[model samples]
Target: MSTEKEENQVKSKKRVSDHGEVFTNKREVNAMLDLVKQETERVDSRFLEPACGTGNFLVEILERKLIVVEARYKKSQLEYERNAITAISSIYGVDILEDNVIACRDRLLGIFTKYYINHYKKGFNEQFLKSTQFILSKNIIWGDALTMKTIYGMPITFSEWSAVNGSMLKRRDFQLDKLLENLEFDNSEINLFSDNKEPVFIPQPVAEFPLTHFLKIGEYE
Candidate 1:
């Protein structure tokens, strides 16, 4: 097959559906997104574009949020700018394709760096990239958006979320707050990282073949 076809296939593989071609049409999408933006309060809101193909949705969301924040908080440009950057941190996304994922991630971060560096004196954390990978990984993830599963290539169920996230609920010795104190989870202590609340990844089984359907369960009684 031709390079054009191959590229399209690779890109499409990451798309949410076969109709992804029409989804990239900016004029059409921006119109709908604009209508949606009208109903929501832009202040401190969080949104997730689970399948972030090329980040068109994210860009529009950011643009609309900036306008809203700037108009509402005219005097505190710093507040507006911070609100904008913080709003970006609120947006989360995932895409299966590496190229699309990285591209979307860079575009979002570029908007942030430009605004923070230009408008504020107390700019971004200098080691923002190195220190808080969430700045990179949190906003835009690289995985199947539908599954919300671990990198283990399996679909995460409510049970898994309960087990993983609930691990925190098990501890009572530290005042229900110290779990995040960096004393650590997953056999590692918080002292190693200096903070307990930060997230840690758990290891899981590898996939010999892509497991598309998730682990199904019956209704909870």
Candidate 2:
């Protein structure tokens, strides 16, 4: 029943040849994400797309999570904003192309803004938008996933945003390479085990910031 143009899948033949950047169509993206429907609906569940070209997958995931956020928290603007922040904060992406990264961030922001406006209209909080933008800038990376490094050859770092004491958010940064290394080792035969005999891989944070109010998180950066 959907009527999206096939031409939208690829920006150009050169991009396909140069970067192999054919985007996943909406129908296929939905089909694939339906495989993990529950996670897509969970606001705080984290997702990372290594080659998220304009965020076909991430945008769908955000929309699904925001629907849930609205259904559960729409009555309270504060609660809606907090859960909305959590939803956007948990979605991450990486693209080698700078343009793709910028577009992906904007698309996700637009979705969040649209939903917020639909619910709050004139009461929309500017600080919430700023905080969401800050989170997107940190969450979506302009980096090579294979190399686990940014365009400038620096290690790709991601921030873990956790809501604390209701309105406060705690941020911790972890390097992509280190996280993947531990994840791989954790799944190997010689897996690391916690005291309770459960497999665990606790990655050390590169940096941690003081707890800041969710709406004021951008100011802390």
Q: Show where candidate 2 strays beyond 4 Å.
A: 1-11, 182-198
Give the 10-residue window scoring lowest on summed lDDT in candidate 1. 167-176
Clashing pairs in 2: none
Candidate 2 local lDDT, 1-221, one digit each (tens): 43355455445766888888888899999999999998889888888899998999999999999999999999999999989999998898999999999999999999999999999997978999999999999999999999999999999999988899889999989888877673533442321112234454657789999999998988974
TM-score of each: 0.53, 0.88
lDDT of 1 by residue, 121-184 (tens): 4644444333113344545666664556434574421111111121111100111112123333
Show the lowest summed lDDT stretch of 10 residues, model 2: 188-197
TM-score of 1: 0.53
Best by TM-score: 2
lDDT of predicted model 1: 0.48
